[model samples]
Target: MIPPALRIRGAVLVGPQEVRDELWVVDGRISFTAPTGTAARDVRTVSGWALPGLVDAHCHVGLDAGGAVDRPTAEEQITTDRAAGALLLRDAGSPADTRWVDDRDDLPRLVRAGRHIARPRRYLRNYAAEVEPDDLVAEVVTQAGRGDGWVKLVGDWIDRGVGDLAPCWPADAAKAAIDAAHAAGARVTAHCFAEDSLADLVEAGIDCIEHATGLTEDTIPLFAERGVAIVPTLVNIATFEGIARGAEEKFPAYARHMRALHARRYDTVRAAHDAGIPLYVGTDAGGSLPHGLVAAEVAELRRAGLPAQAALSAATWSARAWLGHPALTEGAPADLVVYPADPRADVGVLAAPDLIVLRGRPVAP
Candidate 1:
């Protein structure tokens, strides 16, 4: 039974624009977004912010489950993280590598990008889900064919022992991967940390660039022309460097590179915004940071010169749009999130939601 829908009246923050009114969630989809000029019965009052739940476009909850793939297994950590992450999820990452979450989930929804398609020996092999040559095309096709928004390509991998950058996919291979995903009606998101193999990804018509660390000036305009989004994950990189520097008692040159890239991420994102090129928010959390802390990305985006509203939009409405859900019409599962302050004014307002509605039901989990 679709219980009597609730209405949150106050700062009706919907996709960056704040409306001083009340919003009704009838049977899940937004029933009415009207001014709260008068009070009515059965109206649940929330004196704060209300907007679409955030879509963390990129994250690696499973990858952070530190430990070797030994016989002991990391099933618990993987399952727990994914389940917990779902409570406020719009998380995009590979679910194949991590122990598959087999929980009675009613929280965050998973729109996986699946296993990263890369060469056998690559820079991210330690992190990637590992797609073998024989199953590479099929795997890419599988995720894309299922209408799972995007296909993730591991174009860069961190080498074992040496800790150097390794090119994962050649231009031809990347082109093939993109073509396969395109054929399946999916966009390809390339993980690029250096300029060495970036040209191939751009030339192959990949949809988005993740961790725009090594993007040259020549590349910035091409992304604009092709209408591909650039998702700069700077914060997580910085966070990782700090942790490594603290944990290892050494600040390697890699830390400097990540720091430089983080700065470049800000500059390029601003450049993209000014040039009318799309920039999405992504925090590659597995390598360093924690999951469910995606709001940092919004804050970073704002710091990068985007208006608070636009940054909020990139997290909410834009993210929903990215997932192909243009409208939250009736009969749609109730997926509502309530905040207590203007998220645009301070992206940190999202840290603690007053209420979260998932699948037409209130949280009892």
Candidate 2:
């Protein structure tokens, strides 16, 4: 059955600030004008605060902690995210192919980064296209073709030989691979958790960094000058202490480093923001962390010293624009969420969405 035409009233559009009284959803598209002939009963009116649908910049759909999962499990993950009002998802990396989700109108819109490209045995098993430095360029080209418009790389990981976090790719290899991905019309982001790999990746013209816990005064300016964005994934960073405890006995140096990074997590983010480095909210969900924590990530950004509006925008307007997704714009897909109160006033209101509309149809929140 077709969904009723929606009349969203008494809500504020987070950005643009063009229409305050109402906006209409017709045939799964946003329209500012009233429908000419629709009967009153055929129209559904929803009232509350409205904003562009939430965006999860770093999430995995078809993978779990153990690695690639079956379709049913992936669908469940998507459902959990949808329930939490995340109508758009950027799949950071996934070993399993989830292209089938594109055909399902009920599923959240997804932009995938193919599978992660990592060095042999350097990344978690079964989660990356492990290739040696010599093959980095070729693998990036291949994954760039496989992905929507972005590619993921494991920039650094624990080097057991060194007993601490270390750069995964040599500078020359990273530069060449990133160039290859760009030639294929794809932007590249990397999973970076240490200070050493960041300068190399940024100097190579990387587009974004994930879990950038190792940022410092020296590297912050580099990232800012290059305009490289970072998704702090503070929600996932909350797990660092537990991980350090688990590795303390075996890798004391790595453990201590992780704890130190955790200790200054908020300060690191604040400094990055002050340096004008672009920040986006990402939960790093579908790894060890659970899905549907976009709200939590926004709250964490606030804790990191971003203003309330800036933190909310990290997950909403600003994030959508960064990913080239339109937000609450005319003729765009009608994907949005309604809140009981102003989320900018207190981001905690995000945890409880009054209604969620995906493709102009109201879905249960």
Candidate 3:
């Protein structure tokens, strides 16, 4: 149940420079002013430095390395993310139907990208709707209709024949599929880890790219010019070395390619940011990696050259705005996180939030 009207006192860091002594939550929505007819004794009080709930823009909830998981596992993943103060989750894509989460008030709010559409045998087994170029447009429309305003595509993957990363969809097919998604009222994003696919996807009007490790001087401008966003998922990219080593025996060329990409990942992200490409925090959790690493991902962003405040914004105000969610605004859902110190000075404080309030209820401490 919604807790009694809450009075959040102390430093409420609504923005980089905006601060307030206190704020109130009445009936699960934020109220800049106190509510009427509420006794002082009846309102609950919390104190700390508060920030809008963090966002994970490219996470996967009902998915694991093997594929779609059971409901209980999905619930566990959701709880883990909620505990980490990730109150808004943009589920990048998943094979399972997670519509049941909408009814859960205590769970983190989700914006799903129905499922990953990839070329046959190009993606993780059982994790995508694999189809040929002829079927691309139809699948894009189908997933766009199924998702919450977004659809995902696997733009590139390792081509076993060539033993190297290659673009999955031809330019014509990509353009047709993207147009179809747009017509269906959904924005499209893609999983791209190679340079060859960047131009085509950007030219085709894709809204965003996930694990954009291949971004370089040539393509960064195209992405920025097109107003497309990128989620670096630095935390996930850190595993590239291990992935390369695992494939070294069978695919030496692919191994070298992965290592090269991993070595220059920081430079790629830094260049993208320097070129005005929109960067957001995405831990890429729920595959082989565990959930609740939003803090780590923000730290990684900082390490990749974003200032402390900018890095924090990747998971906070900026991210929420991009995802079409409100942040610490009047009449918005009262989802926020409290930390012991100023996060702008050092983002590491996000690792241990002092309190987490979701939908007006204090859910963590």
TM, every model:
0.79, 0.97, 0.97
Models ranked on lDDT: 3, 2, 1
Q: lDDT by residue for model 1 over 86-140, one digit each (tens)? A: 2333234544343243244443565667555566666334555566545667778
Off by over 4 Å in 3: none
In order, the Cα lDDT scores of the candidates are 0.62, 0.91, 0.92
Q: Residue by residue across 1-365, what tens digits does model 2's lDDT show?
A: 55578888986574834447788888898888887664334788888889899999999999888999999999999999999999999999999989999999999999989999999989888899999999999999989877889999999999998989999999999999999999999999999999999998988989999999999999999999999999999999999999899999999999999999999999999999989998998999998889999999999999999988788888888899999999998899999999988787899999999999999888889
lDDT of 3: 0.92
Q: What TM-score does model 3 achieve against the real structure? A: 0.97
- CA error at residue 317 for candidate 3, angstroms: 0.5
Return model 2's CA RMSD, one decimal: 1.3
Against the true structure, whose lDDT is highest? 3
